[model samples]
Target: QVLCGDDRIDAAVTQVISNLSSPFRSGSLLVNKIEAFEGKELKNVADLSAVVVIKSLADTTVRTVRSSRGQSGAEPVAKLVVPALAPTPNYDAALKQLIKVCQEVHVPLISLPGFGDLAQIADEVRFTFLRQLKLNSTRLHTFLMNLVVEEGLEGLVEEVSNQLNRPVSIESAQFSLMASKNMGGTPASQQRSLVDDVHKSVRKQLKVADSNDGKDWIIPTLKVGKRLVAPIMLGENIVGYISSMVRPNDDMEAIAELLRPAALAAMIEFHQNRQTGPMFAATQKSLLRDLLLGGTLAASDQERMEQHYGFDMADGILVFAASALNAQGQPLALDGLPDSFGVMTEIEGTATVVVPYLANSGKTWQQVAEALQKQLKELVKQKPGGADAQIQIGAGRMSETTFDLAESYREARQALIVGSMMHTNKEFTIGYGELGVKRLLYLMIDHPELERFCEEIIEPLESYDEEWESELVPSLRVYLAEGANLNSAARALFIHRHTLRYRLEQIAEILKVDIDSQEVLLNLQIAFQIRDMMSGSTGKRG
Candidate 1:
């Protein structure tokens, strides 16, 4: 099935391989043919180097020269030459032949590279190529929103740095409209300082050398800081900067290119974070105020807000009132108080106590007052000794409504004011029954004219005749006026029963009336009521 030919066939086969392997060129391969022979026609033709005269029956063009190896006397063999055969084949055999040819030619052949294999060597490199194109298109969208929801900007930076195996420092984080000027102008200087440091560090760490032909390339080293600063550009403007300090095994220019996309993502995220700061602060304030007022939002509502807006609801509440000391050590402005507590707007010139209506741990209004009093007492103790410091506290009333709060505030303030007048330097006071009335009475007692009126009413008794002043007159007045109860009269006057009886005898000697008589008791009772009424009415008019 096979035919042997002249050595010209070997020369033609070699030319075909050379033409296929060489880049595009002219006159590289030429086909040749020879007549079939029954046996080997050319002896020792392997070592012969000479042009063969090829003759062909077909009309293919051929150029030939006389054979130099044969004697001039011998007849030359005719040779036929034609165009070289094409080198097309099946995929499997082609690959095998290509490999074999490469081995024979001492050349290396490689198939197209895959992503998975490249990723194992350098994942950052792979991610960079993938995310850069996609992330650049999304620069207009605020990325900070994602950062805030996932974690804060700082946390995001830390995480990204960790994932990339780099040490990162975020600088000049700001948020505004895309077209806005540098909003952080004053702080830009500080940012520049950090940038400069990063630049110096990076330049020192990166070792670059020039080849003999003056081509620049980098060498690997780990002795110095490798710093990288990336500008986060949104559209035509730069929005922020990300600085990284790292030591990499390879050239960092490639690494910097890889980090650019992630930096852009982080910048977008930081911008969104800045936009929500005020909203977060406002939400926090509202929640704290609500809890202090004892209003409860639904758990679901809270969850929704916290999820959407990232508000925290775990803060504690406190309320306080300010009381300034007067010359006589009495607390002032203690009347006609408002129900709901207001935040202490100012307290530097005077002292204020912020009373929280609602707090954690089920503390009643009374307990709140007690705690405030304790705090105030501590403050007083810290003041200079012998300074005549005076403070009074009233019990707090618990209620959820702001309307009810005023009454409690008023009662507590009034009680404190009254206690200040009654007892000097009292730490705290609670209003109960008669004490509550006394507290109200002292509100009127502040006027000196009222005190004069009260004194005028009692003045007549001080100047009564000697017989009236004698123990008998006072004993009869107290006994008969006090419902003829001997023990009550004796107890009211701080006297023994026998001593009270003796005093009654003396009263009989002076007034000549039986102390037990109903008529006398009625008259005495009327006289005492008249005296009290006169004093009270005069004081009021004064």
Candidate 2:
């Protein structure tokens, strides 16, 4: 106020500032010069092109007056100057914004105090900026080296989100989600939409750019990512990215700078993850195998496993074996099923699940297995060829402890095999306890005597059915299974009672056995069981 109140001083100062700020066509002609050095404004100088080079920050925001990563509205000057602060809103905002942008791009932000000529101030700023750049490089170097430690990529993103008051996510080059925080609990559809939009824009850039786009470490400044984003690169290959979860809101350049440390941190994590991911997975899988197949787990491993899963070794577990396929009939991987679904393993194309025999949460192990299957169905439906996927599970009796799991695994496996063989026309979930007489048959599933007995009793019916294109063996098995009741047998076979009676007569005549004898009926039931067991048992039958 005092400076402006003095009319002579104000006039003199205004004239000096105008002369200092302009070099061409200033006092005698119209000022007609513009100086932009590689998309950055040279503050208080007409061409710092040879003085200081500026760094590019992927100009993600609109390349207009608001872009903090580039000089869009401001013009170059011929001498050192600072925008004298004012009360107006536009000047305040622009001045503060330009100061920040220049500081970040390492452009000189010079100030003039008492008694300094324009040339003197310009000389001083050149030296000051050089020193500040060296200092900034050192500080940034230190900040990036120890950016992330034990927090991991997930923790690091969460931390960054907290600091920025915005959501953040890291993803693979293919946009596979790695870590995220503060992204609303929206459905997967919403999440995928967000990723799709961002990736689509990035792909366009990748497609249009020349061959040497990233070759010289120059990533094109994005113009249409709804959120602030930076590529996380390893050499020329983009391993992944660090990005904002929401749309831009004035902190675009600040977010870009913040993401650099995060990208560096993520780079460290992704590098280590790639290096150790498979080995780590193999180790965990092997451990899961040992737990399911009853191999010895070292004491520490056992204790850790017990604590990790919150199951006690003394209480024992229920075993479940499941076979699943995609709609294309390819084996489904169930090991990495989300934790919300109970833990399960895909061992040789079969899901082997073990749950505590009794969960204090009041849920039974069978309920847990059912829940896992339900979740798995939902999970696969999100993938291609998932609607027609087949999933059949079998259960074994509850075991006494970890020591008894092997027996349970064997029972569960055979139950699946035999049930699949018997229920060839439909899907099934078989339990060892529900096998009835088939439980005895499965015990001898690999026995030659069992195979021969089945062949002796049912081979004639099978051959007759094959030759006549009939279902004699199936009808007879159903008849015997229904306690030789003609009405039930006829209903099951979808035929009339008289037809079933005639079929029974043919069976009795062919086998040369009495049709009304209970002894013969029991033998027929046993023979059917043998047929299913022998037909279903594959290699490694127990």
Candidate 3:
């Protein structure tokens, strides 16, 4: 009975293997037996049947298995199985099956050879994955080199082109991708709106609707027309817009994928360059302004100004004092002036109005004076309360030499002072020559001391009012004019020499001084100079 049972068991097992190899029955019968024998009272029998089923399935697939008995008569034996070839058709499904077989036999670390084609496929997939991860040219280059090492350059190029969708050309200097476009039957180069179209396409491709839009997935596309404009964002701000003329192709994908990293780098670099340019320009202008207004200049600075701005020591320079007035004739602040004529008002009490006088003629002073006067008048008239306001100008003379500017400054200041005092409501005034010193002195006739001095000097023959009167002042003046020659003085005065002597003695007696002494002569000369100074007369004097 035991021998018959063993023979029957062997026949049943052989029939099971034959049935498992049949294409239609193999996969189904293996799966059914696994499901049916999962758990039962006949656990050992079920386990043995599961092992037979797994081995039969492994034989059809490119997989291997090793069976062994447990040591010391353990209840269950352990079997090891590994896939000799890479999983066919479905890797996920095949891997799951291999794991299931190992679990049934309680195997550990089943060694299996990878699929025949898995190396190449995995490599390509890895390249694509690495390409996606890279965000710069350097990384991309490294990936390309690795690809070339595994599969030569030509193969790499073909694979990358096929994967990305564009025509890729690699050169020593640069890598480029080219795509043809037909815009309204016009050649891309000749199309006037090519740039616009491209921009629109890029924008559209990148357009993202707001959250209010119901779509769950976002489609990223390059828009080239009015319909599409997608902003390239950096942080929260849009740095630039990207437009593409070519449709997405395998080659184009590779190019764009390559360009994405490069584009980001380029954008950052471009933004930095843009910011730096304006800063540099602003720094230059600030330096120029400081040089012009700082009141001090270095030797190099002076040379630069002279060469670039035509400022030279030989240029005739003058200073002028000017005050703006309102329509009411009241003084207006310097801030009210227009921006022409390089008007610069200093912090000092006065404004140093710069007027460029190109001509070498003496009349440059007059021209500048006239211009200032005109501007002042116009400013006064335009002011709100300028009717009563008076615009006064004091212009200094021009000097060919630079050192004389101090003199010019003094002249202008004096002119402004005297002009303001003497003339009322005049728009401008010139000084020194316009109003004589004698007349100006008479205006101070109320001063008693000056009157007393004049009276004392004209005394000795105050009653002699005639031109021929032998007045003490006239006598002394004549004597001094003749170099203190009594004879010549007497001749000039039409008096006898003795008579001149007697008159001089009388003059000295009245003036309380010696007639022949050097001290008295010096005193008299000083008095004469004082009189001339007070009178503002250039007339000849003894």
Best by lDDT: 2
Runs off by more than 4 Å, candidate 3: 1-296, 304-309, 325-329, 335-342, 360-362, 401-404, 431-542
* Candidate 3, 397-478: lDDT as tens digits: 6645334444655556556655655444455657434444433454564567764665555433344424445466777878
Clashing pairs in 2: 45-77
lDDT of 3 at 309: 28
Estimate, for each residue in 328-411, the C-alpha lDDT of model 2 and write its tens digit.
546554445664444575444467777665545687666766776776677666667767667777888888766677788888
Over 31-107, each residue of candidate 1 has an lDDT whose tens digit, in order, gives: 11222111222222232222121222222346565565576677776665554533422244434443344344333
After TM-score superposition, what is the CA distance of residue 92 in candidate 3 from its true location, in Å?
A: 96
Ranking by TM-score: 2, 1, 3
**Candidate 2 residue-pair clash tally:** 1
| Superior candidate under lDDT, 1 versus 2 | 2
